[model samples]
Target chain A: MQSGEDLNQDFRPETEAGGLTIRLDVFQGPLDLLLHLIKREEVDIWNIPIARITEQYLEYLEIMKELNINVAAEWLVMASTLIFIKSRMLLPREPAPENAEETEDDPRTELVYQLLEHQKFKNAAEMLFTREEVENAVWNRPPDEVLEDGGDVIAVTLFDLLRAFQEVVRRFESQRVMEVAQEEVTIEQKIEDIRKCFLVHDQLQFSSFFTAASSKRYIIVTFLALLELVRLREIWLFQQQVFEEIQVSRIKESA
Target chain B: MQAVMEAIIYVAEEPVKAEQFQEVFPEESPEAIRRALAELLESFNARPGGMWIREVAGGYRMTTRPEHHEQIRAYLKTRPGAKLSMAALETLAVIAYKQPVTLAEILAIRGKKSSSSLQTLLERKLVCILGRKEVVGRPILYGTSREFLIHFGLNSLADLPTLEEFAQMAGDQL
Candidate 1:
């Protein structure tokens, strides 16, 4: 409470005297800084006095610069905007519109509007932070509680399967480039190849499809063909466990 | 009936709405079902176990207590817990409030590029694509998902507290 002029004084970047270091982490963006200013000054958002707020905004930037905090460009753009509005406010006012009151219309109206709009979202953000903080403690129960139903099937999404494919792809992939004209392996042909491989064994490893593939094109084509089979539910792709070799199994349609 | 209710809520995958239980017991009233729920809540609250049933996203389900998070985290080392980055959480907050919003709209509010964060949220099933926004590019509309509600322990969209509430609290402390 020492030398505290406002309630938001704690949130404002506290400069360390005789030492220089400020946490820029607190500033979310340009609007966040403006919100801090408005709160600290207790200014009426609808009728902001541009000169004072702009001065304070620029001073914070100065301190940030002196303390060697890397400020983002958006913050500087806002600074320019505030300065422009303050300069306009200092100039003589134009005559009011026919239906408008002189005091009601000001050059600061647009800037104030933007600030108010940003403030609403900022408040929502704060609420979300609290929810995250509280929910971080509450863990979802085990599979006994079935909110989302249907066969578990490993709960693998297309992206997750793709990532798993990448891991296996890295192992057997050769670095040979294939010209389009030299190797025009269609996805259908690759699928046929995979089917032929599965005929020899009930299951095949992820990298087995790329076996003897001299070019990246063949490997990519084989991967795409696998994805097509997966999409059709003709085959299922999964690892025995996490980080294990991915195995492809044929769906039991008779069951 | 309450014991049956407790088992059903604990075993159910999603939140067990009272209407669902009402359908099972055609003659029972919703008020009676609600009373059963209140009794269950009281009984659970009285216990000191690491698990408790909570009404989240419109139904009741058991969730692990926060105090046991560290212990459970250690126990469940094989699996990854649902954790979000600051940027993603901020973006989610905006979408949770102003849903059916576009990437451009989110970027405008966050004052930063949010494509990566949006992708992460989509992958986590926390945010979902609600369809095109009917704007210039027909950009995909984004909204918070049922998974989002469950993850955040929200009973419904109405459960979200206004942001100014926290700011007001800060003011009071000052």
Candidate 2:
């Protein structure tokens, strides 16, 4: 049933113009926007009225342009795809042979499939959103409040540790002696020194390694040794919580 | 045995696995520990209390019941990270449903460049690189991480509602 003419009549530009005042960011992508358009139009997903939809989709892009929203490339690509499909569907199909075995190919087939697939995940995303909403309400004991300043559950990355190290270095530089002195600190020697320290204590603050250093070279060497130990899995470096001191724990054999 | 198991689970910093319980009680068989865990789970569920013993990421953890969420929300000063963006959620849904998927496959389904959303998911530790696909370009394959299951309070990936179920739910909503 080709309701193309009826849908074309139904596509009122003025009414639709006001309808699209909502933000462009509401759509996750082109498919999401198309699905929204299809749902709003109450059209069959399998047999989308492409001419009407392409017009509406372009209108949306135009609105986004007017609103000064950066329309992603994917939206433009889908626009062309809709135009191509609309043109293909408008063209008359060649007559098939009496004994033709192959099914008729519709240009919209690929798009319909993509839309259906995206819709499935969209629905899945909604389901996940609901679950997340419910789960967010249920608090785990000890709360696992990662955003807390001293919460030990939050993980710290190599970048955070490096930033902390930079701060330590900056402080040392600010309070350093004016005299330049060469230091004899090797990475291997520093690594051995760290290993010996771990043998006595289960854990040590990261800054503890640099406290005895007399020169910047010694601190740099110690940092390198720490990295080497980490690479070797001989020691573990981690913050107990966000914005807290990083602790270097010995990697016991059992762990 | 149930009380002992509950205490161990309560004291755990993270979800305590059945294997961990078995490791803790070396003399007990795996089946015995599993039975005790099942019993403990049932006992907690049977009571109309504030606490729920949930199985998340294949491990047990204690969490306040959702019914008391509004009260808890009012009492607590800080909250968990902000909810994920729609784009990030959609990308995560694709990766969760289709594990070992490449960026190309995800782009095909989403009909969008998912790199940013993928980056967000990776940063949140919800999605992880499974390894590279053995294709021409060897694009990185992605899958949901253990944190993903925990975030949704799921026992495992299998606990996620089926796509068919989602379709039905969507139908009802519409």
- Indicate which candidate wins on DockQ: 2
Give the worst 10-residue stretch by lDDT in candidate 1 chain B.
B165-174
Residue by residue across A112-143, what tens digits does model 2's lDDT show? 77777777888898778889989888877663
Q: Distance from true position, residue A247, model 2, in Å?
A: 7.0
What are the lDDT scores of the predictions, listed in order?
0.73, 0.80
Error of 2 at A105 (Å): 1.5
State which candidate has the highest lDDT.
Answer: 2
Model 2 root-mean-square deviation: 6.6
| Best candidate, TM-score | 2
Q: Against the hidden true structure, what lDDT does model 1 obtain? A: 0.73
lDDT of 2: 0.80
Give lDDT tens digits, candidate 1, residues A96-192.
6798876575777776656666656655665666677677766665563132432233435566667766765675454544544565789999888
Chain B of model 1: TM-score?
0.85
Model 2 ranges off by over 4 Å:
A1-23, A97-103, A143-255, B167-174
